[model samples]
Every structure is written in structure tokens, then in C-alpha cells.
Target: MPNRRGLPQKWCHQELEVNEMAFSHRGNMTECKWKDKRDVYFLTTKHTASWTEVTVKAKGGPTKEIKPDRTLDYNLSKIGVNSNDQCICIILLIEEKPMKWWKKMFFHLMAHAMVNT
Candidate 1:
């Protein structure tokens, strides 16, 4: 379902489960094992409105999903962009200052090293 701004109106839900187990082997060595599983669902709405709300539930374990409520407003003038052959130029102005004695000496040494190499 497309909204007024031509954007899709859909809600996505996901569930994840993690399991950890530890085991001991020979030579007093121990290792930890991990397991993970996930489930996802997508819900789409065709109605158009300024705001919408959705509720979700989890099958097993405690539910940790939180959905935010919000609204969006669009205007035509804010979406304008230039794509034509028109050229845009930018100019930067700067003031020059005399370098310190140590800085001048460093640049001279670098220039001499480059020329020798």
C-alpha cells in the first residue's frame, strides 16, 4: 500500500531466541555453545490517514518489541532539485600571513629532501 507521498505503508515485526550451553572436555578445557532462531512478519495497510497505530504480540517468552507512533507531512516546494545544464560556481576568499621561522625551516628541509630523492 502506497501512502499519500507514494511511500509504502508497512509494519515489520521480528522475533529472536538465543540459547547458550557450556560443556567441559578433557585436560580441564571448557567451551561454550550458542544457538539462535528468528521469526519475522510483515503487515501492510491500504488505508490512508495522518497517523496510524499497530499492536504486536510474541508467541513464546517475553515480548520485547516496541513500536513508535509518528506522523509525516510533505510539501511540494521542499522537494525541488536542479538537474538541468545550469552551472553553479563557488568562490572562496582567503588572507595570506607570513610563516614563522621554524615552519619556514621545516618546509625548506622537506623541499631539499624531495629534490635529492
Candidate 2:
């Protein structure tokens, strides 16, 4: 799409993808290949394909594993559910004093409103 100046917009940016081969010296683009039975590919322009060590706990204790920065950041960013579900959970955590179901529901809604405010 063009702006008011009649210049076309930049439609492409070097971003990340899953399961990519080792590449270096590329412009803001990188890929991470995860070891799995299936062929996995990762690509990202915001990070490099270099491996960094992170701690992981197994049956035995804490151990270090090397993974790409893009992979780690992507993994960390995933918050499975939407904010609505999270809000519901947060608002329902208070223990009620033997109240009716409807009263409990009202309090829950009130809590949700307070949090939103």
C-alpha cells in the first residue's frame, strides 16, 4: 500500500521462522533448527542463530541446554490462553464464606470489574 506521499509501503521484514539451517552474516534474519523426528525449521530477523545455554530441570536435577535466542524468546512469549480466561481465573481465587452460588458469581464479577478498572 502507498502512503499519502505516493510511496509504496514496506511489505516485508526479516522475521523469524521455525526450523532453519545455520546461517550467519545475514541482515537481521536467523533460523533455529530444533532436533525432532520431523523436519522443523525456525527463522527470525530479530535474533541470531547462535546457541545460548539455559538451565533445565530433569529427573536428575538442573542441567544446561544450548538453544537459539530466537527459540527461547518465542517459547517464552507463548501464554496459551487469552486474557479473558486469565482474568476469570484471577478473579475467582478468593475463598468465599459459605455464600450462595449467585452471590459468589456476583462477587466474582465485581472482582473482575475492579481488576479491569
Local distance difference test values of all predictions, in order: 0.30, 0.57
Every model's TM-score: 0.18, 0.45
Candidate 2, superposed: residue stretches over 4 Å from native: 1-28, 36-40, 79-87, 90-117
Q: Per-residue lDDT for 54 in model 2?
A: 84
Error of 2 at 4 (Å): 34
Q: Against the true structure, what is every candidate's RMSD?
A: 23.6, 9.8
lDDT minimum window of 10 residues, candidate 2: 1-10
Give residue 92's error in model 1 in angstroms. Answer: 23
| Predicted candidate 1 versus true structure: per-residue lDDT over 88-109, tens digit per residue | 1111011124778887666655
Q: Pick the candidate with the highest TM-score.
A: 2
Against the true structure, candidate 1 reaches a TM-score of 0.18
Candidate 1: clashing pairs of residues:
none
